[model samples]
Target: MKKKFLIVVLTLVLSLTGASSAFAYDGWADSKQTAYQFQFPVLGVSIVLNSATDVDWYSYTNNTGSPHGLSAKLQSPPGLIYDFAMIVGGSTSYFSSDTPGGWVKVTIAGNIAPGETVYFQVRGHTYSQFSTTAPYNFTITT
Candidate 1:
């Protein structure tokens, strides 16, 4: 009876530990980041990358049959290396920030198909500094 009780207690402890470990705060990369639901004319969206390893993700749905016009403007803090990118069908286009507190805009070709997924990611060009204030606005004109 004593041995059975001890084994049961050990099993419970190990199970609890394993369960807790499953939900640990795991950081995300571009490959593993969660996709945020996006629709066009998103405006004045704010984000902060506390470190160079941070990546922000937004996914867009294009339902327009003839292709849609996509644009984004990032308001980046001055003195930081920042860029936003558009990724679709393994193709990429980027807009880089040239000045702090300046707007960086990118125009994507409207060749995207309906029901296709477009991913927008924001990150630092160099991972040495942090961005304290970053806000971006986006639009899709069908």
Candidate 2:
């Protein structure tokens, strides 16, 4: 009986440890359905493109009862290329840059109506560059 109890406890502990490690990356999931939601006008939210296929998603809603302009600006690390995009209503605006260490901006205002939500995606450009030690930061401007 003691041996069986010990095995159960070890299994529980191992599962818990694995679960904790799964959420270590910026506390955000990798899909649009599980994307992290944040308030608009956010400044400098740090994120990482940890792998070649890692894509991060975020959403923001316009609830001001009026149309407001929205912009996504990404600042990539040196020697790495990144892409940024925004989906407002049915319209999509994408921005990509080959120049490392610069800010790429995407703006869409007229497409977002009052009470409408928009989604943003950030990822490595065409599997060109990814960094686990370096993080690319972004800002949502209104």
Q: Mind sharing the TM-score for model 2?
A: 0.74
lDDT of 2 at 110: 64
Residue 141 local lDDT, model 2: 70
Once superposed on the true structure, which residue ranges of model 1 sit more than 4 Å away at CA?
1-33, 40-44, 132-142
TM-score of each: 0.64, 0.74
lDDT tens readout by residue for model 2, 16-88: 5321222216446577788677663343367567777788887888788987787778889788888877777
The whole-model lDDT of each prediction reads: 0.60, 0.73
Candidate 2: the clashing residue pairs are none
Which candidate number maximizes lDDT?
2
Model 2 off-target regions past 4 Å?
A: 1-27, 40-43
